[model samples]
Target chain A: MATTTTPAATPGRTKGTGKPAGPPGRRPRRSLLPYLLLAPAVVLELAIHVIPMLVGAWMSLLELTQFHIRDWSGAPFVGLDNYRVVLDVNSAAGAELLRSFRVTVIYTVLSVGLSWVLGTTAAVLLQRPFRGRAVLRALFLTPYALPVYTAVITWTFLFQRDTGLVNHVLVDQLNLLDDRPFWLIGDNSFVALLIVSIWRTWPFAFLCIMAGLQNIPDELYEAAAMDGAGFWRRLRAVTLPMLRPVNLVLLLVLFLWTFNDFNTPYVLFGGSAPAEADLISLHIYRSSFQTWDFGTGSAMSVALLLFLLLVTAGYLLLTNRRRNDA
Target chain B: MRETATERWTRRIVLTLLAGFVLVPLYVMVSSAIKPLQDVQAAFTWWPRRPTLQAFVDMWSTVPLGRYLINSLLVASVAAIFSVAVAIFAAYAVSRYRFRGRQVFSVTVLSTQMFPGILFLLPLFLIYVNLGNATGIALYASRTGLIITYLTFSLPFSIWMLVGYFDSIPRGLDEAAQVDGAGPLRTLFQVVLPAAVPGVVAVTVYAFMTAWGEVLFASVLTNENSRTLAVGLQGYSTQFNVYWNQVMAASLVVSVPVVAGFLALQRYFVAGLTAGAVK
Candidate 1:
């Protein structure tokens, strides 16, 4: 991985043509061209992404109420009051935010863990040659290929109380339940959201793991098998070790995407999410847009962003340390 | 390795069951889209009893679905093309040239991906509102505003993907081009870029799909006239009378281009995704 990335990271470092030096005046101009070429993208990224982040942090500090939303410059400077409100566990709002944060954490852990495990299992199953593998691969990838709204809206229909397929299958066909279950409205909403989340995301994990599987040399597996290693033993000794780096990257990416995911819950639940399934993204969105509290919303988001940054840094450190130790 | 009969049968059965699990929701969606409203609500069937395009036809008249689709297409295509075009030049510079602050610039590009996009919503909304107020340019509820926002998210990933792609091309190609007296830009376009066509298409597909399915930004940034398909889909159920058939029909329509696009370019998409992860 390091070798593959170094070319882009420090290209032209080792390539000294050993040709006669260019004219003294021409070197500087030639060197500046790369910067010129990179300017538009750099500038746009800064203006569109970076500057707004700074502004968001600034907005979090102010008392930007709905009355002042139209012209925000005049909004009062609250100096962490918004953060205080969100963090004040004694307050009803703060207590709710804390509960939502806990909910978000649980959702992220479950969604990421299930997707990765299922994905890795599927990838291992299909790693070797098989008949009709091509068709099976395409079939497995269908969920990931479809747009999120399409998939989740279909889930919304399937989770309908009376007419949905899930209930029909469980109640009418399988006789598992006597009455229709309200999937979208209660504690079951969390279960419903998890099913949709895992359904949409597992294929992605499968794809990444499959790609990672390609890099494992076949010789190691052959040697292990010769040493009297069976399927589980060979997998544990050879495959998992080789897949560590890929899994690290995959896990972090999956966690981040799932944690920041806004579309799935929004589409499945519509405008306001049920309390049981209130992931932080929708919670913050409602606080800001639905209730017209941009300051509190920004503050909550800033907190979330800071939390993610800390988590990512810690994850990278732990993974890198483990890799080095191994 | 050779497999026994039971092992082969087991693999087949497990894979087939997984495939069925994957396809069931999609089967439900397509079937619901064509089924009559009564049939959809009253009882579930494997296939539509009276299959019709009436729902698809009615979706348009019901809520300006055509306009939403056209708006989504226009925004997605423009953003994809423009973002990829800009990213190619930046990618080339990073991949080929050694410049001051190169490491910092590259890391900055990667770091942008880590920030949650919702963090930008409030500030960007404020910026657009203020800019429109000052200049009388209507960005508050316009496609242009949405396009610009989408570009930010799309550009970073596109640049990163293209950099990996450009790096894979042998340096000898550029060196040979230079020997023949081709300028750096000319060599980039004439020699290196032609080889990176797969990467370009991969980036284009990625950017297009990102913009196509975007709901959070589109929901906030667009209104009636400027609404994209994503937000328009929301309107179908939010109104007093819920139209399940039309909603499903509209979603199917909105998803077709992206699904087809991903299937056609599945190879590139997988390559692009793995390139970033493994490297």
Candidate 2:
């Protein structure tokens, strides 16, 4: 193999990987090429996402109350006061924030768990090829493909207490309830939000798990079958073990999405989410925009970010350890 | 192996029921959108009996539906193009060169996904206000501003998807390009990118679809002149009296492009998704 050295290629990287040839025609000085190529993306990410995140942490320290919002620099610097406000369990607002956080945790668990169960069941069922399977796959994925606002908006109408199809079927058709339960209000609002969340997300799980399922070798199943293993046994022994990597990634992603989700609940519940179904995301949004308390909102958000980062890091460490053990 | 009749029947029955569960809300959406107000609230009819375009017409008359669509399309399209363009360079560098901080860079990109968009909103809002005050660039209430925000949210995922895609393209192509005297940039454009067409389409669709449907930022960031379809649709609900037919109709209208795009580019989309995660 004729090895053509890349002018700006890393000193130690171009060895032993059996990589292909470098592209032709290098500028005489190519040491800066990679940086040049990467600059725009790096700048944008830092400016928009990274820097703003740090700035949010700083703003969380300042008392960016409603009046000072126009001129945020003039906002009083009250170090950790906003965080104290959120964490102060004795205070009503603090208690409410804690309650919303609990609701968010429950929401995330139910939403992720149900979506994963449904998605996995569907993926495994559809793994065995059959006629019209392609159409069925497409049908299953339709919810995920549709716009979030549109899908959730439809769910809002569907969950309306008076005219909703959900109550019509559950109450009128099935006689499951004595009355049309208030789905879009009261404690049932959580159920309503969960239904919309699960509907929108499961299809993604299905798609990912299906892709994972395709990678498993049929021989493993056949071998298990020959050993007198039943379907469940075969799945446990062959499919589940084989799919651990995909499942870990899928579950983590699903958790992250469900935890951070703002759109579904926002659209479903409108601005002021029912106290029972008030998710932390909506709660934070209300704190900042609706109530014009940016400092407290930023503090809650910072708390949320730190919690998520811890979970993510822990998840990664657990998965990496498992991989090494395997 | 021969299939058993019982097994086949069971699979069919289960699939059909699941499909119904999946399709019912979509059915309700379409069925309610075309139905008149009387039909919508009258009873639980699965299909519209007296289907009319009146709801669509009413929605258009009441709201700037056309302008909302145009604005959304413009924002989504530009956001997708810019995000994908910037992502290509980063993805290419990561895929082709094993430089210092490469792993850190890739990990950072993945970590960005963990930070919720709301985390950026307040500070970005403040920055926008401050920057606009200092230098009159109108970053808060403009389509350009909204697009930039979308780009921020979309870039990490796009770059992640593209990196996976570029990794899949054989290193031999670059080798061949080098032999032919093409530079890294040319090889990426001429050899690697064309070969990774599915990834490009997937990234484009992903970014476009995200920007198209994004609501939280759009609701807070854009003004009436620059309001997107998502924000515009919210108007129907915020009013004292929500017109169910109009909301349904408007929801359908907003969904058409995203659904159509997903269907048209599904293969690439699936490939991108699966590749990004599973690998």
Per-candidate DockQ values are 0.48, 0.51
lDDT of 2 by residue, B5-113 (tens): 7866877787777888898898888888899878776656776888998998899867888889999999999999999999999999888886777788878877887
**Each model's Cα RMSD:** 5.0, 4.6
Question: What is the TM-score of each predicted model, taking all chains together?
Answer: 0.94, 0.93
Best candidate per DockQ, number? 2
Location of the lowest summed lDDT over 10 successive residues in candidate 1 chain B: B175-184
How many Å off is the CA of B258 in candidate 1?
Answer: 1.3
lDDT of 1 by residue, B1-279 (tens): 556678678777878778888989988888889988788878566768899888998899888888988999999999999899999999999998888888898889877877777898878888888899999887779999988888777888899889878888888777665544445675688778998999899899889988988888888888899999887887777556667888888888878878877778777767776666656
Query: What lDDT score is found at residue A219 in candidate 1?
Result: 94
Evaluated on chain B only, candidate 1 has a TM-score of 0.95
TM-score of 2: 0.93
